[model samples]
Target chain A: MKDVYKSSMLYDFYGELLTEHQKEIYEDFILNDYSLGEIAQERGISRQGVHDMVKRCDRILNGYEEKLHLVERFSKTKEDVRRICQLADSDINQKNISEIKMIAQEILDNY
Target chain B: MKDVYKSSMLYDFYGELLTEHQKEIYEDFILNDYSLGEIAQERGISRQGVHDMVKRCDRILNGYEEKLHLVERFSKTKEDVRRICQLADSDINQKNISEIKMIAQEILDNY
Candidate 1:
């Protein structure tokens, strides 16, 4: 989950719970990689305002993550899927493949 | 990116910044989903000790994420990869497939 799109996915999953302005700025700055100054100009706000908004939105998102741990759970599931895919890509034995598939299914079921 | 494996990946990528005890307990509790009592007993610490270590480790992990944003970047890349894979799986046009491939390559280059 240390990848860019994964970050955006986490944000997208939980960011909707934030304020509308928070969501907008976060999507632009974080997901789209818009500069703080660019976001400020686009939103007709000061650069500091954009920065503060992003910081606040980050706090909100991370706060939810700490308490709820859904993002953590989701990330672990993704890692398991990647590991299974990797195993399958390699020449794994049938028993190993079945185990990987079972783990994948368990993860999918939980999600 | 909100998947469990993704979360563990993020933790694995950055958890090293924490204390050894912190890392051990966190991996077991979060990644392996060991109970607090279980981790505490295994580590020869009190239940409260395990709880505190996990909380502290969580703060440390989230703190790094806030300041550095590496996990965020990685998560976004994973999402882009998944999106491209999905598009490839579907009957996307040549132009779109080329576009997706280009995007995937760009992502791979960054990682």
Candidate 2:
């Protein structure tokens, strides 16, 4: 289940690299919570075939993550942005906000 | 010279995925400006072999960029960050600074 969430996030970052067919299968499986049997029926393939495709999609996404780390950095950036917001609400210096924003902008712009 | 710089920058982002042999040959040729003959002699390969490896490395790096757009985003983020810095320098709402910082942090964190 947790893997599903991770895979979904990884998909968001690297989904463009996958085939359209793989994208549909992965979306239905991970995001829509469809069973492999259901996905197989929908795609007109064997259940085992569906399983294999989903696993292959996972490997492709994971491989990209291992090398590029777009998903990992994206999660960290979210946390850092949250912290910056919290700090902003407090008595932190406004000038610090400027510097922090530059760093944050750089990260958001890329991923 | 332009191609060399671009390759060097691409290498900064995706060089790790290359084999050690590719890495050494690429660095010597691109980064160190070694002549093909020099690198060929150094690596005990023919000049043609060195030429082929460098072209292969370019294709490999270019392929990753086309799929991922990491390098493209990275270049844009730098530009955006510069803009954020400029905005910070100019007179602006302090609270807006906070909100903008959050976005910037998110971008920077990922790429």
Question: Which number leads on TM-score?
Answer: 2
DockQ of 2: 0.25
Give lDDT tens digits, candidate 1, residues B28-111.
988888888998888899999888887787777776667546667656755655554454345535554455546544553453
List TM-score per model, in order: 0.45, 0.75
Q: Encode model 1's per-residue lDDT on A31-73: one tens digit a residue.
A: 8888889998998999999988887877777766665565566
Error of 2 at A37 (Å): 2.2
* Count: clashes, candidate 2: 12
Off by over 4 Å in 1: A1-111, B1-7, B105-111
Cα deviation of A51 in candidate 2 (Å)? 1.7
The TM-score of the first chain in every model comes to 0.78, 0.78
* CAPRI quality band, candidate 1: incorrect
